[model samples]
Target chain A: MMPTEDIYQPLLNVIEFLGTFAFAISGIRHAAAKRFDWFGGFVCGVAVAIGGGTLRDIMLGVTPFWMTSSIYLICTFMAQMFVIVFARSLKSLDNTWFFFDTLGLALFTVAGLQKTLDCGHAFWVAIIMGTITGSAGGVIRDVLLNNVPVIFQKEIYAMASIIGGLAYWALVELGCDMTISVITAFLLIVAIRILAVKYHISLPVLRGEE
Target chain B: MMPTEDIYQPLLNVIEFLGTFAFAISGIRHAAAKRFDWFGGFVCGVAVAIGGGTLRDIMLGVTPFWMTSSIYLICTFMAQMFVIVFARSLKSLDNTWFFFDTLGLALFTVAGLQKTLDCGHAFWVAIIMGTITGSAGGVIRDVLLNNVPVIFQKEIYAMASIIGGLAYWALVELGCDMTISVITAFLLIVAIRILAVKYHISLPVLRGEE
Candidate 1:
């Protein structure tokens, strides 16, 4: 599949770096919180940073973005070092987790949606890919940590990504500028996630028993 | 991109059915043991039945096998029903778990290795794919149940698949009959797995601390 045009190349690159770093840090911090060792922490960091995109690339029939560049691996390594260095000071900052996770979710959602469209998938498929891109890494991280996936626990996590993808698709359909559409979608996801958490909102459980 | 020749179609079909059923039952039993609800158990069944092959197909740049056939879904459904019907009698039969898991692992490894070779990948890549196909489903199953993946718990699980794959590759290189190569790989994996468990053999753990 083709990448975005040259005009948006630099913007996309920044998103890639920031999103990957945020995700990597989130996983590393989680590893630290759980008292996993250095190598385990690094593995978690890399998994959170690259898992979603790797799945997306495989589905989209492209080489995974991480495999093509050393930058993402370096970002994860830096995240590992950051966690080790800041362990004492960062002991009680749940907000740090929220911020990085939310930011990564928003940015990755946009990137996945745009990449799917670039690969000529329909809007609905792109939206699904965006949600997967946004949440699958966290699922993997939780799995590795032996926790039931938080997203599957009725949180507004993947839903926020889905909502953002829908808004982006609608804006593009309505002839908005590409940058405007991307910004709006990103902000909307962050706002929705924040509001959902602050207000104790969640999807209702689908009970198996009557 | 392309499937195997029609000459091999029926043989592959039987393997797919048996492998899917065995994996589905293995995961369903795990969920039942964990006291998860029916829906949760069903989810695990489907996840284990299809997850490995889905990943393999995605990596091979093919539409996942389950996407093309309804038979796999039916197999999972039947597995779920089998669990419900035999819940009490099956409660203490760990051998049932070993049988299905080992059989599924062996069958899937061979199927994945053959498919990768058909897709024109090198032998080493095929070996990796075989290991993934054999072990990744169990990883997903354990993850869903919030358990450390059994394969990573120093068990000779994925390694058995890799060894089987190497044997298959060597046999093919030695110009053994195709059926002979396939049967040898599948049986070797099963035998290795059984022997490992019987003798308490395991890979050494890599300790995080000195």
Candidate 2:
């Protein structure tokens, strides 16, 4: 008999797809701005969409997601085409992209935490994995462009994911249903990130003088 | 008695320093070729020397090496200065650099395999860690430069590390002394990599047209 699916599975799948799409669009927009050709844009988009997850899986001794499904590749291609077709209009939709990007961060954090917990890791390890899944893709993107990672220099980025992971762990400890814990974690991350950006709340950097 | 007073411990420390120096020099040379500023070159050199081990430690749930030791930072700076001061002479010593690079690769593979085994990982997992430790820094360098990884396209690069790892395992199974096993494994990796490069024995890529 096929095992019954968990109630949260469908929601998690939706979150994964949304996160992947947002990351792909971000990469495609950057590539377009750099005047990369279509194939180059597509490659960059795909890398942005799956790079963090691939790193996580390799670390965790699992096959990468794209190796199991072509959905990510197709989504990246669509993202590239969308950017190419809507370059001028996209400039006006900056706020919309920001919203989706935060949503993607939240979803990725939750998914990564859940997956790490499922793999029998401790809560601390799960939190680290969550942060890596949420922020490493953007770090890779910025590094490729020869820019300092936004996460390394800016707004409550990894902190939001860590907070979400802690919340998820606390809820699980309190015996909350898995679905409720996941939703609460995801919402917490999105809310904290948006608030941080709105208030210009940033992490302090050490500007050591030589 | 302090462990550092032990003969093998001192030897290990010497090898570690040499390996790190070689790795840093390679990174500085590459950054100079790309015309990166001094700070950029220093950062790249440090990243190249320590990046693979850092990744390995993260995956293995250990604190990263540079976090434990500041000496690596000083070594990288020295390497950058050495490259800057000797750029013309160093440019004429490609063979010398290649020799040290291969030796660094061998030492890194052995260190990775040993660390993974110490962490109680299986043989296959240890072998994977060995390859990651030997090749990942170079891959990161290429990626940041927007080039496809040479390991993925060139001579038996990672394969040499894998062979070394397998040899280590085989020697362990045959009840060889740990020191002898490690030395033999490192020698095998260095010999195989040098031979592959000298003979131009490259791996065949999967042609896209096919």
Q: Give interface RMSD, every candidate, in order.
A: 6.2, 10.4
Docking class of 2: incorrect
Regions of model 2 farther than 4 Å from truth: A1-14, B1-51, B54-110, B113-210
- Model 2, A1-210: lDDT tens per residue? 001158657766776677788899988777777777888778768767888777677666677768998988887877877887888898788888788778888887877787777777767667767887887787677766555445644557778998999998999999998778888998999999999999998753322112
lDDT for residue A31 in candidate 1, whole number 0-100: 82
Estimate, for each residue in B1-210, the C-alpha lDDT of model 1 and write its tens digit: 214468877866666677688788877777766665565576688788988888888888886676455777789889888788777666476686677678878888988898898999999999999888878888888878798788888689899999999999899999998888888898899999999999999999887975
Counting clashing residue pairs in each candidate, in order, gives 0, 0
For model 1 the local lDDT of residue A126 reads: 83
Q: Which residue pairs of candidate 2 clash?
A: none
TM-score on 0 to 1 scale for chain A of candidate 2: 0.91
